[model samples]
Target: MTEMLVPTELLTGIAEMDGQHDRLFQEMLQVKNALLAVSDDDAHGLALLSRLADDLVRHYAWEEAAARRYGVPFADHAREHARMAAFVQAKIDEIERGVCNIPALMVFMERKFESHVAHFDLQLGLALQAARAARDAA
Candidate 1:
């Protein structure tokens, strides 16, 4: 009876980023569960979704800032963040448009997270790790 949005094994070797990934996954899972629960209180579900959106915005911002600071030469990495932000916003909009299909949204999130982790998340994490090592040795 464990509810996890993204498996911990998906987290790469960066500590702060991995912690953020875990928190984001756990928060999204909580929101999905609350939305699917047989309860009359929809407020908690709404709040969690809002918080997720806010956290995503902040996380993306911080990630892009780090890339800039570290001089990561991958242009696709920043574009990936923009693409994901748009996708996530679109999902949130769909949910807010009187759609109660939490199951469908969860599926979409799972697919999105899988692709994102494999691509942009891992790239950023690896780049940051390299950057940190270089800085430490210098």
Candidate 2:
């Protein structure tokens, strides 16, 4: 069994964001498992990768919206999101062309996501919590 990409310590404490993160990791794990299976057909893994990419786009948009709502500075975070999306797409393309190293790509993506959540997403989570508290206190 593959280890979880997002560990407990990396959780943002924001319900929706955490859920989305979990889903993204789960999808990626599924893709990894599919690819590692002893089968010639990689169609299922490819489809999962595509779906993961789409879900990541949606997650990024959700985070941006939350950042705006909570007055969190988002320019850097959005840029990071864009970069990650591009990287994932490029890797998917490489996989299609039979040029990708699946294990290395998975390791890289896991580390990248862990760092992003620990830094950017955690800051956004704090901001969101603060904003909600302020609103409730009014």
Candidate 3:
């Protein structure tokens, strides 16, 4: 699997979140590669996809916990996460039914992930940083 560099714009300035984002990107790349490979074993690709879905769920839970700890408003963020999870599951179903366009699906997922990091996650990161700074200053 080719290593994908997380763009600087995607960095949330929170170490753990950044690391998770990196891992997620790598996992997505692996899934894309596996699907694109000219092999009869699509089982490997499907497994990778399932793992990516699971990792995303864990990542979302971690972020939600951090948001609560930092006192960031989380209802909207949690709703967005739920929507994304549902979308991923639907896509996985499509893939399982052999109706997926692998490249397009990968591209869409990558863009959606990047947009979420930029808009939602970055806001949460900023809130977390401010909360920590305030606590330290007290």
Candidate 4:
């Protein structure tokens, strides 16, 4: 069975972001399952990986846009997203080279992603909420 990539605690009280995160988590799970599968469909696994990578890129971009709209300083967060994108590309490269040992990569992504949500994303949520409150007060 594939492990759940998105934990329930990731809900930041931000509806759109929460939905996007849920979808990203599902996509990650699919990629993980494909990488871990013992089947001979290498092409399928690669395709899944490609799709997951693309989804991740889009997800990050969406989050960055949200951060900007919320008046959150997004430099560090965007940089981290870039780093994660590089990491994903590297993992995809490894897979393409027939090195599908993804247990460590999976662990890294899980830990880093969870941490990002707890810190960066949570900060964005708070900032956005505060902005909304300020607007309402004004």
Candidate 5:
């Protein structure tokens, strides 16, 4: 059985962030599931990816702003966000060039996304919580 890409646990503990993560997973999983059902269907994959790309931008922007609000100077976190955006854009380019191997890309992305969220996202959530607590105590 293929591993589900969605993070099963609440990594961020922030309701909004957790919800956003679930939304991303749902969007991503939709494309992945489609790819799995119909292999090498570039048009379908591209269409889904195009929609997902827009959603990702909005989600990333929210996280970026949250990082700032939390006052967490986390360069790695920012880098990961940039990396994901660039990766999705690269996939878009590949599809446009008529050379997309979506299965491989899907597997790689899902694994990376799962781990990134389980670790970095969770850490960011903790940092945000700490910041909030400190602010409340102030």
Candidate 6:
């Protein structure tokens, strides 16, 4: 099954956040493409997954920093970030141990990405937008 590209509509209005989102979208697309091209190559999928996880870490770090700078209630956001990061890391660990399910992992990631961006990231963007407006008004 083919995964859809991350929707552009989800891009946050903040430039740094938006740039990170764009890069993640591109990286995810590349990973999905690589997966499609090498269904039988576990090593290839593993490499792509590792890179994807690494990119996500970088993106989350940048986002968390922005959240902190904007004073966006880091407690809840930090929990969400930790959960997502752990999910990806757990899968990678399982893969390393030769007990991972690649198809299931992809499905989980695709669904998780969609739901996460829709709920968590959307709220983050809205919060950032509100904060920016408030700063501007002041």
Best by lDDT: 3
Residue pairs in clash, model 3: none
lDDT for predicted candidate 6 compared with the true structure: 0.76
Supply the TM-score for candidate 6: 0.81
> Could you estimate the TM-score for every candidate?
0.84, 0.93, 0.94, 0.87, 0.84, 0.81
Q: What lDDT tens digits, residue by residue, belong to model 5 across residues 43-76?
A: 7867888888888889878888998877887788
Model 2 lDDT per residue over 1-138, tens place: 655456888878888998889889898788888877888998998998899999999999999999888787899999999999999999999999999998789878878988999889988888899889898999
Give lDDT tens digits, candidate 4, residues 37-119. Answer: 88877677678878878988998998888777767799998998899889889988987887857767776776787888887
Q: What stretches of model 1 exceed 4 Å from their correct place? A: 1-9
Error of 6 at 74 (Å): 2.3
| Native-to-model Cα distance after best TM-score fit, residue 16 in candidate 5, in Å | 0.6
- Candidate 3 Cα lDDT to native: 0.91
lDDT, residue 87, candidate 5: 90
In the range 1-138, model 3's lDDT, one tens digit per residue, is: 645368988787888998899999999989999988999888999999999999999999999999888789999889999999999999999988999898899999999998998889999888988998998999
The model with the greater TM-score, 2 or 4, is 2
Q: Give stretches of model 2 more than 4 Å off.
A: 1-5
Q: How many steric clashes between backbone atoms does each model show?
A: 0, 0, 0, 0, 0, 0
For candidate 1, write residues 1-138 as lDDT tens digits. Answer: 555445665776776777677778887788888888998787788788888878877877777787788998757766877787787777778777766577788777767866777778787788889998999999
Clash pairs of candidate 1? none
Worst 10 residues of 6 by lDDT: 1-10
Candidate lDDT values, in order: 0.77, 0.89, 0.91, 0.79, 0.81, 0.76
Clashing residue pairs in candidate 6, if any? none
Positional deviation of residue 60's Cα in model 2 after best superposition, in angstroms = 0.3
Where is the poorest 10-residue window by lDDT in model 4? 1-10
TM accuracy, model 5 = 0.84
Provide the global lDDT of candidate 4 against the true structure.
0.79
Regions of candidate 4 where Cα sits further than 4 Å from its true position: 1-5
